[model samples]
Target: QIVRAGAPYYLPAKIAEHVSMVGELLQFPRLVPKKVISVGSPVKWANSCDARGCANLVTPSVIAQRYKLPDESLPAAHQAHTSNSMAVAEFQGQFWKKSDLDGFGTSCHRDVSVAKTIGDEEPHGGIESELDIEYIKAVAPEIPLTVIYNGQFSLLKWANQISSMADP
Candidate 1:
């Protein structure tokens, strides 16, 4: 039996009255980091499972050749970015690493920082940012991408900005 003053089992009137849950260990939630998989250029089909599986990886060059786009188009994957910005950029956007657009197979990413520091939370560790960055970069390799992070989005300010842009 637990004889501690604060343990659930410990229920002495005087001790319980004085200490609700003092001297107890704090149990923080477990943060099981996700296993990073499928990074960099794609791999060709593996001849056998024995060897690291190859194949199935498709890069910009592969996509270009397959679709037969003009050579001038380096990535020639996704549509060009307009003045407003791509749908992905409307929100937090993507930022796994600051590096330029790089994806599997015939693509490149510039080395840089893409995320911001919020409170004690480290930047560039979000699954949303990672996924968005990877896929968007894969399709729009040529487009310049930026990430603007903030503790508060200021919905009122955003609304005002949008309203101001509307036919004044």
Candidate 2:
């Protein structure tokens, strides 16, 4: 409560000095409540916890087929996304297991290039980055993919790096 009251006076100044954007202020994050449930059990979408019903299961092939591929060549058959700055105490970036990717049916990917992970302790931290890669790879198998983890804790740095990229 004190922070919320004081944020109006101090946050703007601090943000102006060091941050390019302000998000999730004065509000709790929207996340699903983690709970143990039997496999294949009924589930509710989003942040709901009540066992309302089973979640819709869509096969990767079906998802891939649902959308048509672009007629134009896919940027030399390459797909990529940049990982933004993670919070302090958060996991550093780390590559997902190749076996998991294969299990997800992305076996067609010849190789994945991860940039800007030379000094990262974990290289790639969460499944989010891995999932991002897997989703694209699953949808468009055989496409070369790149996972660029922005280890910096500042969006401005990531922005600058992206701006400096010749082909993004």
Best by lDDT: 2
For residues 5-56, write the lDDT of model 1, one tens digit per residue: 3554556787788653433234445668998896788556312112133235
Clashes of each: 16, 7
**lDDT of all predictions:** 0.41, 0.45
Clashes of 2: 7
- Model 2 CA lDDT for position 36: 67
RMSD of 2: 10.0
The all-Cα superposition gives candidate 1 an RMSD in Å to the true structure of 14.7
Error of 1 at 101 (Å): 7.8
